[model samples]
Target chain A: MNILAYIIQKEFIQIIRNKAILPMMTVLPIVQLIVLSNAASNEVKNVNVVVVDMDQSESSRTLNHKIIANDRITLVATSFNTNEAHFYLQENTSDIVIEIPPDFENDYINGKQPKIQLLVNATNGQQAIVGSGYLKAIVASFNAKLIQKVIPDISISKQSNTTISSRYWYNPELKYTHFMAPGILAQLTALLTIILSAMNVVREREVGTIEQINVTPLKKWQFILGKLIPFLCIGLVLFTVGIIASKLIFSIPILGNLPLLFGYTTLNIIAVLGLGLLISNFADTQQQAIFVAFFFIIIFVLMSGLFTPIDSMPKWAQQLTVGNPLAHFISVSRKVLMKGSGFWNIRFEFLYTFILAFIFNGLAVWSYKKQV
Target chain B: MNTPIAIELDKLTKRFGDFIAVDAITFKVKKGEIFGFLGANGAGKTTAIKMLIGLSKPTEGMGKVAGFNVDTEPEKIKKNIGYMSQKFSLYDDLTVVENIQFYGGIYGLSREKIKEKTTEILEELELTEVSKSLVISLPLGWKQRLAFAISMVHDPEIVFLDEPTGGVDPRVRRQFWETIYQVAEKGRTVFVTTHYMDEAEYCDRVSIMVAGKIEALDTPHNLKQQFEATSMDEVFLKLAR
Candidate 1:
């Protein structure tokens, strides 16, 4: 235990003494939080949309005005022809294009549903899907209004009186910040844990201090656990910062128990730090270490369902995400922050994370040896 | 006379998937001896040293270091031996005193003992003025010497130096050897490996390894006479054949 303390102390000293690491640890996270949170809204609003008004009729003009007033689509410019709209779409200047076909006024007046076209950029496939749903709703509303004005006799003849009301289970206001801040906590955990823990080992290897430690009476398990404890502390600090940023900066509520949140977060960090150590063991050079860490981090974060809902993924993809610890933590964070879930509600995820953390950390220690 | 042998081995061999790195070589070093383990690059000198120090396991052999079995009690062997590598293993980001205190603390030295040893080791190196300076600011020679001092901070029964003076100037090399001699004078075994034939002469006894086998083991003078050469360098050229 004393030897472990010494190792932890040395690690802390190195982290504090190096002026470069201090800002990277404390300042960079805050800066990333501020910049990325604003840019990371799940609700895609204010889509830059282009209009190709082939029909100069008043009805087409009214349809375009409805789209603009809905605030989901912004008509940056009006294109005269399909060629011009094609250029805007190809150049990525517009996320979507609304084309009003010629003779659209004749078709509506003749009691035929006018056919309109929505040219969507599927470059960001998920956003395109969501944006299409949004656009369809707006167009549907416009079509209803058109039918009421142009053909009122067909509208109310078959209608029956009914009442409908809805309530959101969590995030009653549906603020984007409430949804995002908790997910950001998971991202911060993975980023800080992997980078910090890998750096801890790789720096010693680069500087040749590893040989000094290897010669000591220190057990491999002791040394590994000793290294992990400091990073665990660092993870805790990052988690605290994330919580503060959510409550104070974003004004999101933390409705669950703080201690349970911390307890589960600690278990999740073990897996993250273990991944970092595994990367360190594979890389002989620090550059290689950072690269391996980066590659894994990208895969982990993308598959973690941070930017999209895991439920929408295909069965095979969802099965693969089951193995991703970050996905579980993200769910835990959302449950705790948004829904105010208690220990009983989060018990399964907590237990899963604990076992995964144990297995990953065990493999990491198993791969490491005293040999050169 | 009563001090037991610090290192003992019999039929110690290490193999890497059928390639013999150290081929069943047997040797022993008594307490308070400056034993030189000499070899060319890839001649298995490092592999042998690693096995003895418990950093590696022998494929087939029996060995004991500081009375601990190499196979079962490697950690106990670690507690009794100090190791310094060719790369100068002090943390360049840490100050001289910080480095010393860290190693001493990990070695389980009492705070009072660490304080006394820190001052003694610093003053002995005549580095009091720069003890608080980062090791990166120190010269190469100073770093090597500080590394050596740290290896001995726990007062182990034996100190193993693998190519300790590989890249230093001759003057610094000579000073490093003087420290080895001082360490041996204090009755601690100094087991060192080097390629410098001239430095081999400084060993109380030297063993020459060629092709993973010990070709000659004796005092430098006797090995020279046996090889019909006047110096250890020519003796190596002869045995290398």
Candidate 2:
């Protein structure tokens, strides 16, 4: 125990003595939080739209005017030519082209469903999909407006049978940043801690310091613990910094127990640190450590449900999330912070992350060699 | 000094899959003696030293370092020995005093003992004036001397040096060897490995390895006479060839 304390003291001294560590720990998270939280939003606004009104009917012209006036749509060019609209899409100047077929008013006045053509650029899938959805909402509202002028025989009360109302739970405003900020914070915390610890043991090896430290009477578990305790504390402090950033910058509500978030983050950082140290054990250099850690981190982030919804993923990919600690962490971060969930509500996520922490740290300790 | 066998081995070996890194060999080192481990590159000198210093497991046979089993009690052996690797292993970013203190502290020394020993080492190296300077700021020779001193922080029964004077000039090497002599005069066994056969003459006894086997073991003067050679280097050439 005395030896462990001394080793810990020695590690802290080395860490503090390193001039770059302080700035990296404090500055990196802030930059990442500011950039990533804003950039990773699921909301795609300002989609460039090309309008082609062929029928020149009241409804078609009105649709053109609606598309032009909508805040989310950029009316780059509106023309009577269908080919000209296609040209805007080809030039990459427009994300969507709305083509109204001729005789559209005749069908709409008779209460017949009119077919409106939508030419969407599939290159940027998110913008294409969301932009098209917005255009449909506009068309639906216009159809409802046209329903008011529906042949005098059809009564208003009979025509409007169903009107849907939505109340978004957890995030009433449905602010995309509120939903995404916690996930991004989770990602940044994992990324920074992984990169920081991945270089530690390998740096000792690269600089030839491991050769000295290994010969000491330090047990493998003791040495690994010495390494882990400092990094765990560092990970907590770094995560605390990120949590503050999320609140201050994105206004992600701390609705649930704050200590629960921290406790989970502690478990999450341990899993990541264990993974990083495991990489360091096999990697011969700091460069190798970072690269290998980077490869795994990319896998972790992409499959973690951080940027994309796991429910939408293929079944195989969804199953793989079982092994990914970050996925569970992001889930708990969102649940605890956004939904005001207690430990019981997020028990499964908490349990999985805890299990993953043990597996990873167990592997790290098992792989570490005191003698070979 | 009373416990005469500092190191003893019989057919201790290490194999890397298909290739044998250190084949079965045998030797004993006396307490308080400076034993020079001489070899050409890839002659398994490092593999052998690794076994003695408890960094590697011996594949076959048995050995004891400071009366502890190499195979089973490497942890016990670690407590009784000090090691200096081929590369400079002290933290370059740490001050001379801090490095010494850390090494002593890891060996389970108390704060006061570490502080006392730190001062003693700094003064003995005549580095008290620059004790606060980062080790990186020191000359390579001073860094090496400091590394050697740091290895001795535990005041162990035997010190294993894996090519400690690797890349220095002859003058620096001689100065470092003089420090080794002073340490051995205190009746501590010194086991040092080097490719520099020229330094072999300074040892009380020497062993030359080639291709995973010890080719010769004797005092430098006796080995020279036995090989009809003028110097240890000439004797090394004959044996390695």
Candidate 3:
């Protein structure tokens, strides 16, 4: 135990003495939180639209005005010809082209349903989908208004009798930043802990200090524990700072339980650090360690369901995520922080992460050869 | 006078696939002798030292370090000996005192004992002024001497120095030899490997290795007489050629 303390102390001293690591630990996460959370959002805003109104009717103009009034879409041009609007869409100047067929106001007054065509740029499939949804909402509301003008009593009674209201449970606004911030926090902690621990042991080998330690009477498990403890502390400190940044800077709420978040974070960090040590054990140089760590971290982050919904993923990919510690941690963070989930809600995540921590750390210790 | 045997090797051999890094070589060292291990590059001096220091396992042989079996009792051997590598292996980011304290702690020295030893070491090396300075800031010779001191901080029965004075100035090299002699006089065995033949002359007895085999083992004077050479360097060249 005393020797372990000495090793930890030496590691801390080395870390503190290294000028580059301090700022990286403290400042880089905050910067990533501030920049990546906002930047990583998929929410579409100010979508450019071109409207072709061939009807030349008051109702058609009113529909065009409604589309323009909706803050999500920007009406870049109003044209009478479909060809011109198609040209704008083809030129990539417009994301959506709306065409109202030439229908007399008489047909609308006579309760004849008129059809409209919408051409969306599907190149950016997600943006196009969201833009088309907004367009549908605007047209639906405008159709209800036309009914109110045409038949006041029927429209009022129909609206009063039946309504379907959606209440977004956790995030009423559906702000993507609120969803992304916690996952980004998980990603940053995992990346930093894995990379730092991975590079550390290999660096010792390269510098020949490993030979010095190997010659000593230090046990293999003791050496691994000593190396892991300091980084674990650092990882936790970085995670706490990330949480604070999430709450203060991003206005993300910490709703469920702070202690629960911390508990799961500990398990998550152990799993990542263990995998890092495993990589370091196999690597002979710092460069090889970094490259191998980079590869794993990239795969872990992408498959972690941070940016995309896991349910929407292919079946095989979803099955693979069951083994990803980051996936489990990100789920726990979102559920606990946003949904106010309790321990029982995240018990499976905790169990899986604990098991991952055990297997990975055990493999790392086993792979580290005391003899060599 | 019967000085107890500190190290014993009987047919210690290490083979890597088809190549024998350390062939079946046998030797022994007395309790307080400076035993020089002389070899050219790739002559397997390091492989042999590694096996003795419990860093590598011998493929086929029997050996004991500090009276502990090299094969089955390496951990016990580790506790009884110290090692300094060819490269200065001290943590450059740590201070001189911290490095010494760390080694002392790893060797299971008490806190108070480490404190006392730290002071004695810094003062003995005349590095008390620079004890708090990072090791990388020190000169190469100072680093080498500090490394040697740290290896001996535990006061083990045997201290292994592998090319401890590789690149230092001639004056520093002579000072390092004086320290080795002082250490041997204190009744602790010194097992050292060096490329310098003159340094071999400083050893009480020396072994010259060629192609993973010990070609000759004797005192420098006897080796000179036996090889019909005037100096240790000529003896080494004659044997190497």
Candidate 4:
């Protein structure tokens, strides 16, 4: 135990002495939080629209006014011919184009259904889908108004037998930042801890310091633990920084228990640090350790259900996510922060993370050879 | 006088697949003796030292380091020995004092003991003025001496030095041998490996290794007489050829 303490002290001193890594640990997360959180937005707004009105009638003008009044649609150009509107669409000046045929108002007034054409730029699929939804809502409301004028006594609501109201739970406003902040924090914590710890042992080997340590009377477990404890502390410190950024910068609320979050974070750090040590044991050089860590971290982050919902993934992928510690932590972070989930709600995640911690750390210690 | 054996090896061998790094060899070193291990690069001096120091296991052998079995009591052997590798193993980022304190601490030395020894080592090396400076800032000769001193901080029964003075000037090399002689005079066994033939003459006894086997083992004077060579360097060339 005394030897372990000395090792930890030496490791901490070396970390502080390294001018490059110390600032990187403290600054990288903050920069990533500020930059990635704001940049990773799914909400599409201010879609440019071009209208080609050949009818020039009351109904067509009314439709045009409705499209213009909608906040999300911006009327960049008004054209009398489809050719001119096509030019705007081709130039990328407009995301959507609406064309109303001649005699549209007369046909509608005479009880004839007139056709209208909507051309949406499908290059950006999400923006095109959302822009089309706004156009549909405006046209539907216009149809409802027309029906009301034609029959004053007939009720449009009574015409529909069924009504469906959709409610979004956990996030009432569906703010992308709120959903993403916790996930990003979890990913950053895992990435930093895994990479730092993974590179540490191999770096010692490259510098020949490990030979000195190996010749000492320090036990394998003590040495591995000494290496892991410092990184675990750093992981927690990074976690705290991430939490502050999430709450202060992003306004992500923490509705669940704070202590429970920390408990899971501790377990997650153990698992990741163990994984790092395992990599160090297998890698003979710092470069090899880094490449191996990079490969695993990329896979862990992508399959961790950080950006995508696991439920939406295929069965095989969901099964793989069950083994990923990042996935478990992300689930816990999102649930506890967004949905106010308590210990009992996240008990399975805690259990799984703890088991993974044991497995990874056990494998690391077992694979680490004191003598070759 | 019958000085007890500090290190013994009976047919120690190591094999990596089909290639044999250290062939079966037997030897013994008495306590308070300077035993020089001389070998060319990749002649298996390092592999043999690693096995003795508990850093590597022998494929087939029986050995004892400081009365502890190298195969079973490696931890005990580690506790009873000090090792300095060919590469400077002290943390260059740490100060001279910090490195001493850290190595002393890992050896299970108390705070007061570490403090007392730190002062002694610093004053002995005449590094008291720059004790607080980072080890990397020190000159190579100073770093080498500091590393040697730190290895002996635990005051083990046997000290193993693998090419401890490889790249220093002749003056520094002579000074290093003075320190080794001092430690040997204190009745601690010194097991050292060196490529320099003049350094081999400084040892009380020398073993020349060739192609993973000991080609010659005797005192410098007797080996010179037996090989019809005037100096240890000529003796080494004759054995290697």
Clashing pairs in 2: none
Ten-residue region with minimum lDDT total, candidate 1 chain B: B1-10
Write model 2 residue lDDT over B131-225, tens digit each, in one string.
Answer: 98988899999999998888988899999888888888999999999999999999999999987877899999999999999999999999999
Native A-B contacts reproduced, model 3: 0.83
Better of 2 and 3 by DockQ: 2
Per-residue lDDT of model 1, residues B98-199, tens digit only: 999989988998889899999999999999999999999999999999999999899999999999998889999999999999999999999999989899
Best by TM-score: 2
Q: Of models 2 and 3, which has the larger TM-score?
A: 2
CAPRI tier for the interface of model 3? medium
Model 4 per-residue lDDT at A57:
90
Pick the lDDT winner.
3
Candidate No. with top DockQ: 2
In model 3, what are the clashing residue pairs, if there are any?
Answer: none
Candidate 2's docking class is high
lDDT by residue for model 3 (A8-38), tens: 9989998888898888777998999999999
Candidate 3: regions farther than 4 A off: A80-87, A103-114, A147-161
List, residue by residue over A65-94, the lDDT tens digit for candidate 1. Answer: 888887777777898888889889899888
Over B106-183, each residue of candidate 4 has an lDDT whose tens digit, in order, gives: 888988999999999999999999998999999988998999999989999999999999899999999999999999
**Ranking of candidates on DockQ, top first:** 2, 4, 3, 1
Query: Candidate 2 residues A5-92, lDDT tens each?
Result: 8878888988898888787778988888787777777688788988787799877888789878889988898788988889999999
* Arranged by TM-score, best first: 2, 3, 4, 1
Better of 1 and 2 by DockQ: 2
User: Model 2 lDDT vs. the true structure?
Assistant: 0.88
